[model samples]
Target: MILGKCPYCDDGMIEVREKEVSGKKVKLYACSNAHWTTEDGEMFELRADASCDFRVWQNSLARYGKWLSYKDMKDLLNDESIEVELISKKFGKKTYYNKHISLNPEYGVSVIWD
Candidate 1:
């Protein structure tokens, strides 16, 4: 199934490819745009099989525009097709956790919060 658009180029199409990693074959679907290829965006993986029930995973990852807490990072990552990085920030004598989420940089969708 067509999971997502390239998000970088209008003419680009997301495609699936099979590659061997750690001696095991895996299926990967990712955007075909050069920018996405360079930045590693919109990528999904599933084990090779005759059939893969990946729609659920894909659907869950496609939701957006909601306030989410730190506990929802995993779902947010999947939803935005981005990775989350934890950084430590010091305020006065205390340390707080900060989350940096990378979304469409060109569109100003990326966010950072504590």
Candidate 2:
């Protein structure tokens, strides 16, 4: 699935790819024209060929283990107020708390705990 445009590159689009990490499959959002050789057929392959280096994990948009939708991400990017319930586990106990979520340039998303 195409998520959106790359925030770092002017003409690059963000595309979703499924990859295996540590024996588990996960989704990663990467720039369509990111760091890779023109000879490489796979866009997901990372190479130091001097291209846009913009990629983000799908779970990076998750708040408290809940994945946010594209609309939610767009809303957050627009500075819309959003309250998320964060699930916290400590010492084998589970608890929930509320937090405000926002988009971070370095990170895909961030939650305010304070």
- Candidate No. with top TM-score: 2
The whole-model lDDT of each prediction reads 0.38, 0.64
Summarize candidate 2's per-residue lDDT along 62-93 as a digit string, tens digits. 54566666555445534545787778777878
Clash number for candidate 1: 0
Q: After superposition, how far is residue 42 of candidate 2 from its true place, in Å?
A: 17
lDDT of 2 at 67: 67
Clash count for candidate 2 is 0
Candidate 2 achieves a global lDDT of 0.64
Candidate 1, which ten residues in sequence have the lowest lDDT sum? Answer: 50-59
lDDT of 2 at 22: 53
- Per residue, candidate 1 scores C-alpha lDDT tens digits across 20-91 of 444555444434442222123345333343122211212122223233333343343347644443333346
Task: Give stretches of model 2 more than 4 Å off.
Answer: 36-46, 61-64, 67-83, 103-107
